[model samples]
Target: MLEGHALGVHGEGVSIAPVDFSLARGGRLTLLGETGSGKSLIAQAIMGTLPSGLAASGELTIEGQAYAAAEGATRRALWGRRLALLPQEPWHALDPTMASGAQVAESHRYLRGLGRRRAREAARRDLVGLGLGLADAEGSLPGELSGGMAQRVAFAAASAGGAPLVIADEPTKGLDAPRRDAVVRLLAATPQRGGALLTITHDIEVARRLGGEVILLRRGRVVERGPAERLLSAPRSDYAKRLLEAEPSRWPAPPPPPATCGEPVVEARGLAKWRGGRALFRDLALSLRPGEIVGVVGPSGCGKSTLGDLLLGLTGTDAGEVKRAAGHRLAFQKLYQDPPAAFSPHWSLARLLDDLVRRHRLDRTAIAPLMTRLGLDRELLARRPGEISGGELQRFAILRVLLMEPRFLFADEPTSRLDPITQRDTLALLVELARERHCAVMLVSHDPALIERLCDRRLVLGQGEAVLAPESLDAQAV
Candidate 1:
């Protein structure tokens, strides 16, 4: 159903060298790559949504119809009906002002040619099936939903059109194992229905479950192309080998915790949060000490991120008192779940980092070495946040926080977008820096193995409850 000859992307901030490929009807092709490896670029090139500064070239054949890939307008007409691209950042595709159900309903109404009543019914069904409560899903906007919640809503809207050709970019990044499985099933359904499915993801597990063709990319070049099972189990490329090794399960368990943690940096008691008339969590009590690592795990739309917000004072708890130790006001920092939303599109990364350095009177000399350690290309500093891949921008966010030498850091799935190798390394650095700085860390992640490996304690929040697991992280702790 899809074929490309020398199809590639080129632009000011990013570039993907030309390559050739084809996808027959009922076929699935997954793209695996590091952040900024041009994975999303290929999907955008096919969708004809390349940014203004860039353009696509070569030839593309869709549904057996040939056209110049450069002629984006031709592909634009197919959007929402014949083809759909679920973006990496759900915010980019979601209408912030619109209610979640309304957005999905609109797709069904227009693209699927359903009446308002039927469309609304379908939207609610889709949302509920994805584990969202109907009232909560319909009443809330994109900004109010968690990253995983928003992603599921976005998927519903994109797929509501019943488009045969679907291109999903990092669809399962912030989702729990169960939800990830649900989404994988949905993507697999596209091909099972005799339509092609193209996905871009850093998740090796997603690739394994989908059981299809895999294309591993590096710096815009294809390094391996074959069956998913073969490539994942017996990858020929060294980079691919490292990717498999970087899985949280393969990582060695972290060293044992200290005999006694340092004094408390922040403490909260009787914390409670509610959204859209639904209780998220209540009577939650926790404390963070210098050099301590606490992991937060819960299902999508659970109170994991909300708890962070309450602790950071970004949002007030419905019922609670929080105490922050005497320290620099800026010593408490937060790394956002969606890096794009946390940054401004108007400014280059360099300007943003510089402003932070100036505002805090930070050590300017530390920036260069930190960038190198984080695998950030110096050239990326010249580009705006919107110009970089999600993983690269996320690392930049981490870099910004590390520079501040924060007393307490709330990291909301900070490495979700990064490739496995990068995720492993970046997190290791985060832990190392936090310990060196005597900083406390509160990390929220969907991967339990990751939490088990890195944290001294676990907070599992769901259905109006918060359970603090044991410090040793034993099975009973969960």
Candidate 2:
């Protein structure tokens, strides 16, 4: 059994209040809250890696081991064997300089005392068992792998430790429907494999799928705890009710119809990309009419985000011509999945947007309105990208693009980093702006619930080609 008794932690000028929760043998618990509610701090505290300047007073026990009583080396030794953690961002968890296989194999040596060859072989086998190809991926680095692939690799490594206590923090953040299901199913089976799981997430749907028990955290406090089904169907607490009500999946009405009588703002004929004898998105043709929102859904590494780059002229296409409507903005507005890496750290928010505005020669007077529409306050504009949350940067990126007033927009997993309330508001803002400007909106997302809310038509991609459905999206409500 894994348990946290009267856990309390704090840093210089920052306070982390005392919290209490527990997970029994083979039990599951989901920690839900808005960003910065101390979900991650709890995970780190259990893992014995609380950052410096942070003091902790807590009783964390795992099976027969007294985790709170152990010192530095003794605690470190227990990590991969007694307690394991799957962090939110796989890239941050992985060492980019090392090969994927080597990174995973290291855990085997540390936990099981296995030889190098045997450890790598074991890691390779686990990767294959997780539906990932071992031969091609084993030799690759995290930078070479896609977002979904990296997450899978990280999960594979974390699970390979075979720890009694497993902590997964938003394990399926950027994954698609099927991949997300696969990852969760894999983690759910961990209990039967003799591991207890503590999942930190804001997604109730994911929590329901990994059902065991639920613990709701709001503003650094435990507001509710019970069976997931009971809590989801009829929440007992007001905090839980507000959290569920704000979910975009619970929308009351369908989205408004796409604007009509508009020319195609962006068109691509036979778009293609080939590398290392692998062809991605061959003969991919797409036409985006002004004021229409086209949703792009596909598995990981299937070239959906790559298509976004081609649309923006960021990547070179092997064969095909892309044409835009006349007088269309030279630079397309885009919100990348990793917004922090997309910009320089030295530049403040204002400097970055101002430079882009000047470079694009966009309307200077629209700045205030643009920021206001994206729900950005004056204080945030003065902060650096490093100082803000992922959701804030994502919204700020959209605001920057809106300043250019591009005739066409491409957003790649824009809502993946945002919580439920912000996701709903952002979707609504995107819809309103597209209609008002008569811009073509190409939304690439893996969330079915999101596609149902914003898109007018669906474009599903598989086997390296996009398949367009003729049926209008008004009827695709769940």
Candidate 3:
């Protein structure tokens, strides 16, 4: 259904090397790579959505319709009818002002040619099929929904017309295990309906679940291509082998028990949070002790991030109290899940970082070494947040928070956008810094393996309450 020959994309003076591939009807192909490996660029090139000044080259054909670089009506006709895209960032893909259900209904109306009333009905059904409730899903706006919900809405919009080929860019990016499985099943079942699937992701596990062929890209070049099982088990390229080896794992030797934890630096008692008249959680209690890593984990939309916000005092609690040790209010720092949101769109990275450094009275010489350790280029400092990749932005966000040398740090899914190697490195750095500074770390994540490996203790939040799990219980939960 889709074919590309010598496909390449270029902006200014840089370009990804040309690549060739084909996906037959009902076929599945996964594109795997590290950040800036050109996987998304290739997908965008296929979808004919390359950013301005970045031109696509070579030939692309969708359903036997050929074009050098499809444009105008040729591209428009192919997009919604024959081909659909699940963007990497659902927030950007969705219309913020539109109701979630309305956006999906619009897709059904335009792509499937359904009447307004029928489209609304279909949209509700689609949302339900994706594990959302009809009443809640229909009433919520895109901004009101969580990351996982927004992704489902985007999926509903993309699949509404039953297009023959779908290109999904990190479809399971922010999802927890169960929701990730749902996406895997949704994409895997598409082939049975005569549609091909092309997935671009940093997750090898996702690729494994939707088994088919694997294409590994490195530095914008196709380094390896083969059956998913064979290549993953025994990759021919060293780079591919390293990528596979970076999957999270239990420590070979358990990390040295943390040094005697200090007194509680921040504590929350009888906390309650309500959104839109719905109680997200109540009577939640947790404490962070200096030099200890406390993990807050639960399924998506269970108020894990909300808990982070409450601790940071960014949001008001409906009821309850949050207490910080005397003189420590300014010592609280947060590493946000959505890195872009934490940064100013109008400011360059250099400006933002410099301002933070000034506020904290930090040594100016410390910046470069920190950036280098996080695998970020010194040159990136001059670029705006939007000008960098998500992985780069995530690293910058981590650096910004660490520079504060806070008494307590709240990290909300800090490495969610990173590749496996980068994730491991970033996590290690966070832990190392926490130990060195004797900082209390509150890590909020949906990643079981991560929580198991890094946290000294864990609080599992679900069904409107938080339960402190024993170490033995935590081991079995993963």
Candidate 4:
């Protein structure tokens, strides 16, 4: 069994107060809360990554062993062989310069003392088991793989770690529905393999689908504990009730018919594109009118992200004419699907944001309100990129772009790393900005529910082409 009692984790004043909880062996528990309600901190403490200044008191244990009492070497041995953690962003967790297979093999070699050949062989087997195409992806670098693919690589590494306990923090944050389901099933298999899981998530539906026991966390304390179905269906506390109620689909949808006001801010005609041999865009034509938000959705590798890059002129088109309105200030931004590595780990958030502001000659006054809206205070801005949550960094990236006051914006999975409430807040802010500034926003996402909520118009991508939703490609001639 795993347990935490009077677990006060603090630096200066207590950041996380006394909290108590328990998880039976082979049981599953989910910790849910807003962006910075101490959820990540608790996970960090469990993984022994908490800082020196911050001390953890009370008791924490795994199986029959007290985790807090374990010696350094004992703890190190326990980490990968007996316990493992899947951090929020797989790409960030992955070694960008190493081959995926090499990285996965290294995990096995280190944890199990397997030789190079044996580890490589085992790595290939695990990758295939994780629903990845081993041949196509084995030699690829982290940057070469899609977000979903990178996440699967991370999963394969964790599985190879041979841990009996797995702590998955936002494991499905950026994954589409299909990938999410695959991960849920993978977690379900852990118990059958004689393992236990602690899934930290903000999405209730995820908790519902992966039904097991749950411990609902708020402000570093457990507020409710019971069967997942019971608690999500009929919560006793107001916090739990609100969390259960805050489904993405529950939010109001964007107004229909898509406000097609003003001139076109982004234009592309007969845009054809390819990477290696895979065609991403084929004879695609689309236009984004000022003051409108357009959503592009498709399965992974269907070119949704490619279209965004094409729109931003980051990728060249094979055969097409693409144009941005004259003197169009982009204030254009893209919160990378995996944002942690988007900046240097050594650089402070303030340094990055300040560089962006000064380089673009943007007004400095805009920083405070944007940071406030994104739930970041002054203190957080001073920390290094590794110090803050992905949600915060994602928001900071967006704010950095907003300060540029671009005439258009290209956001790819902008809210993928955020908690439910912050997801709503960020999307709402984008929608508000589009309407207020008449900025054309091109949002690339795989979430249908979010598309329905934030998009003014929707496009569905297929094999190298995009078809306007509710308006067939056959009717485009009209």
RMSD to the true structure for each prediction, in A, is 1.6, 3.9, 2.5, 3.0
User: lDDT of each structure?
Assistant: 0.90, 0.76, 0.81, 0.76
lDDT of 3 by residue, 347-408 (tens): 88999988977886887887888888898877777777876667778899998877777888
In model 2, where is the ten-residue run with the lowest total lDDT? 469-478
Displacement of residue 319 (Cα, Å) in model 3 is 3.0
Q: What 10-residue stretch in candidate 4 is worst by lDDT? A: 469-478
Better of 1 and 3 by TM-score: 1
Model 4 spans > 4 angstroms off: 12-14, 69-74, 113-115, 328-331, 470-478
TM-score of each: 0.97, 0.85, 0.92, 0.92
By TM-score, the better pick of 1 and 4 is 1
Candidate 1 lDDT over residue span 1-478, tens digit each: 9988999888885668888888899999999988889998888889887777889989999998898988888888899888899889999999999999999999999999999999999999999888888876776899988899999999999999988899999999999999999999989999999999999999999999987899999998899899999999999999999999999999997898764466799999998888877788888888889998999988888778888888988899899899998888788999999998989899999999999889889999999999999999999898889888899999999998889889999999999999999999999999888888889999999998898889889888777887897646453322
| lDDT string, candidate 2, 8-102, tens digits | 66764435577777777788888877655667777777777765555566777768666562133356766778778997767667888999988
Q: Give the worst 10-residue stretch by lDDT in candidate 3.
A: 469-478
Candidate scoring better on lDDT of 2 and 3: 3
> 414 in model 3: Cα distance from truth in Å?
1.2
Which tens-of-lDDT digit does each residue in 1-478 have in candidate 4?
6787776677743377777777776678777777766777777777777654566666678788885621223456678887788877786678889999998999999998999999999999988876676655789887887787788888888778778888888888767788788888888777657778888887677888878887777656667888888988888999887765557778865556454677788899998888657776687888888787878777765677767777788878888988888764544556577676578888788888788778877888988987887777788877877677677788877787778777788888888877777788788887887778878888877677777777766787766667775421221211
Off by over 4 Å in 2: 9-16, 48-57, 64-75, 246-249, 260-263, 275-278, 325-330, 343-393, 470-478
Instruction: Give the per-residue Cα lDDT of candidate 1 at 14.
Output: 65
- The most accurate candidate by lDDT is 1
